[model samples]
Target: MTWLRALREIVRSGLTIERTRLEPLVALRAAAGVAIVIGLALWLVSPAYAASSALGAFSAGAATFQRSWRPRKVIALAAGAGLALSTFLGYLAAGHLVTFLLLLATWSFVAGMAWAVGPTAGIVSAATVAGMLVIITLPTSVGQALEHAAVIALGGVVQATLILLFPIRRWGAHRDALADALAAVADYARRLSHDPTAPFDAKPMMTARSAAAVTPSQARRRPAALHGPRGLAERIRPAVAALADPRVGAPAEGPGRDRAREVLGAAADVLDAAARSIRRGTPAQVPSGAMETLRIDEGDEVLEGPARQAAVRLASLLGEVLETADSCDTHVVPAPARGAADAPPLLRPTMFRLVPVVLRAMRRELHRDSPVLRHAVRLATVACLGYALGTALPLGHGYWAPIASVMVMRPDFHQTYARAVARFTGTLVGVALATGVVQLAHPDAYLSGGLAVVSAALSYLLMRTGYVASQSFTAAYVVFLLGMGGEAWDQTVRDRVLLTLVGGALAVVAYVVFPAWETPRLLDRLADWLAANGRYAAAVVRGYGDPAGQRRADVRQALLASRDANAAWGEAFGRAKQEPVRHRGLTRREAEDAQEAVQSLGQAAMLLETHLPERGARPVPEAARFAEALEADTAQAAREVRARRNPDWDRVEEALDAWEGADSGMDPVVRRGAELQLQALEELATAVDRTPLERDVASSRQERHARAEEEEESRRERDTGPAPPPKEEG
Candidate 1:
């Protein structure tokens, strides 16, 4: 019954689907591309060639359209060449049993390795494998193969030409990415306005940051003058958070609170307007009276001390946001500020490089006991095995098995199992539907071709929604595609269903036998995150008293590393939770607490970085000393996490208490920033301390209960008498 429940859970998870607003547009683009290719092939060539050409065009265009211009050109050419090469190889290997098997296995292995290059290369490689299967199954001579390959290549050319000629949605993705980042910032500000203590959700902002960061850096292209919106958002986040800090004394009630709320609300409106303008490529019109709301009177008695400080900080950040939005709206880069050259380079090329640095990364992974290398090898092995089994068995359309295997297997056990279930179930439904359509309607070549185009478009549209919907459309597309190419649907439907089941089973078996379980790796991932945060905190603290003109490149690097580490830990933890109860290394509560601690540490570091006073501002020696002490304490906490021991917060707490009494005689803004940073550090330390303490308490309680049970058992045995055991032995 337990096993049944687990299976039911897996099925439910696999079936769950989601759709985004962009689906209709994506579907339309894909459908139009395929439809045009099919129309051209039907007009200029035979129906048999039309099917193969349309398939090639659809796959290549779907993969390349969203990329930048240069990459799109490269992908289009590479994908077309891959298709041609695969078709040629298929013709040369057909009917020769040994040669055919060897060719398929070798291609499968190469395709698996192509994933190490990058996603675009991986997509093209998979498309090539599909092309090979299609061409190999049909009888062809050298001349006929050449003609077929040319038509397929021509199809790719058509897609690329359309992109060049139409130019619709140019830079639309980039615009949307930046818009989303601004909108996320506005959302955060609104939340802060309502309750300074409101839980901050950083996931949306992080996702938008990642998207905006993906723009390719090319020497020939004019760089977008301003840094990504993420930088602006990061600079603003701490100020918003500081407004809610009780230590900052940002008025919890009365007229001051109302004024703060009004400012935040108005700022949010301006940000929303900016995002809308960027997305629509129009001039940004600041909301009426928003600038007026941001204006702070110098001598307002009600806004004294911390409230005054918060209002000033909020006004400054809002001004920066407005300037950035105006720059984006006008399509003009802002002039470099005085001493801009001396400022730290915040937007580095490491993340935005056009050519991926994956090869060097893969090489490094191969030198260690890396899960990436293990997964790659496993994928290649499984792909070859699936191909050999399908070919050796008496299954018709044997290529489907290997394709299914390649599509279903992932680096992690969780995804592999989930995808296997989804793929098999989707295949069953798709085959039944396709089979029924063929039997009832007896569709001709033209109808079948149109149906194939529609299904292909739908598959690409729902690709991100989940595996099941995408697979269902894909299976239906394949059925219609083969039918249009003169294969009877009746004969292919059963083979598709059986082959998918076999492939899914093979994928599951492969992972079960040699799983890369995330449970054992969870601790290491968490430790890495802690170490990264520690380094980030240290860098920010060390630079707090540095020359105002100095660049903090180290801080930026550490922040990026910490973000990457956090993401890695989150992925590993999520997979670990989905494993069986006995296999889970940490409880859900323990993981969540640790995650919160790491996030708090990151927030503290950001606060310290932003708190550093500008040139000519008063410096607080006490603040600098406190920051250094906090840095050392954070490092110690990281070491403790690595050692799987409780963090010692006693010394850190004492330092914080001592700092509270020390008078720095600094400006209110600097003092408030320092207070917020110190408070955040304390929160982080407390959260870190709670994890091991809770675990110890739970352990002690369990031990006491066990001891009580043993005592009860002894009493029961004494009452029953020991003579019964001896009598049984005699």
Candidate 2:
């Protein structure tokens, strides 16, 4: 990964157009909100006020387009309120550059650190900062500032009102998340029918869990169909896995295995039906043969032990799913996916209450090495520097520099660089085209306002397509906005383009200088994932040992922890792949193999979870000790991995060997499950088994070779800079 190649990749990615599903009605609805606000402002006040309203309305609408589980109207309102507050405060400090710069730096830092909460929060917060930078410059007097802020908020109000009046695809995202989870399980069943040891990606289930966390208002109104299906989906996964597993369910290459495949096919059909029903809000259309296929005959012995129990359980759960679909309009299920609590299960705090939660999250990221903290530092530095530089330059619209910087900058290397390129390229072409249109057409104030609204609408329409697409129209919208304010198109064009370039450069350089590479932390992420999966697996095993006393809450919490760890590892690995840094502790091949082993370990746990007995049923004395040993061993292994040492599974082995055949009537199913886990763990150890010294030496040799090639490439790049331009143009 040479700098030149990375640079090429960044540009290519930034310019790439993603084909997104177009939501025309939603786009038009958002546009209408902007139009209504602009019309009211123009009729009551002036075109200038209309511009302010449009900015607020459009920005708030834009925030709704971002991926979030919260209600869109709520997002619209919050975005509006945040924009109003930022605009008002920024106005108060606008007279003094020193005060304005201080405020800008603080706001930018907070916006940057908001990533600790989530991308939706971080992106919306950054949007607010961008709004503040530009909108603050408009109002002069205190009274005028208050009026501007109020009207800006009115835009959000309009958007929210439209959403309430004309609800399109209400609760659609939640339905899709649930449907996707069920669909994933259905696909797994189908895959397992062919290959019994197939792997299932956990993303869909994790997404469904995230979607299930609703605000109190959402919980009361969520449809009954969204309730129990997710939990049913969860139960179905393990049952199918256990049934298909040769070790626990059926013998391979025999009539038993054929029966298992038949059950799997029926399960897949029923799961797919349930998924479709949930997605479309219709009754489950279970296949005619599905139920018949699942029902075992009285004398049939195709499935025995844990496998038979799994079949029975899967059939029962699938029945409930079908019943749930049929009765969704009339009744709520007693046992909900989130437990017998809120209908939708997880009740998140209201927006007002989320302030403290977000604050605590940000506090945790205040450490020196935290990526969010580093990003905050970078954001604050670049913002103030860009502002100061823009002001020092002869460019008229100095705010463009910081506005570009704020909007383009992100918490990662790839995005920060890509977005910078996108913004600059978009602004150049967009500003030029808009300026050309204005110069040639000579549109009036009202026409310009209409054009601005149209531009904003176009930007909204294309938001999901790619950053570049939306940004191009966004620049045109700004151009039309300034035209409405009576600015000469020619006078602003050069300044807009130059300032955008300056801001983008500052943002890119800032990231390069204050880098937060994920390459070095690969081992840490891998260890965290291992520890989380271990906890989840141990909790499930413990449930078998102490079913009556087992709090399902423990399993749920461990499940969430594992999901978070898996996501962190996945995101880190993705970023690391694109990074132009040498992987030190682990090679790409080793890391990937280790991840597969880890995922297989989780899947093994899911297989065991299928056969968890009735709460008051007889407890397994052997499992309780094994669970303890598993917990202790994995924790130590995680520490060993972090310390760059080869992990030893001595405790895990001891737990397995400790009481083998001690009790003559011990559960064979539990023992087999333990064996599966042991096999997976040993695979992980094999994957990363190289000694620390050997790993280091091998990594160094590889790094040296890569560095020499990169240096050679860089030397050639400098010598042949002119030849690459034609290729770039093409």
Top candidate on lDDT is 2
> Tens digit of lDDT per residue, candidate 2, span 42-92?
788888888888899999999999889998999999999999999999999
Across residues 514-577, which tens digit of lDDT does each residue of candidate 1 receive?
6777887776788788778777776665554443543567777787788788878988887787
Highest-TM-score candidate: 2
For all predicted structures, in order, the TM-scores are 0.82, 0.91
For model 1, what is the error of residue 251's alpha carbon versus the real structure, in angstroms, after optimal superposition?
3.5
User: How high a TM-score does candidate 2 get?
Assistant: 0.91
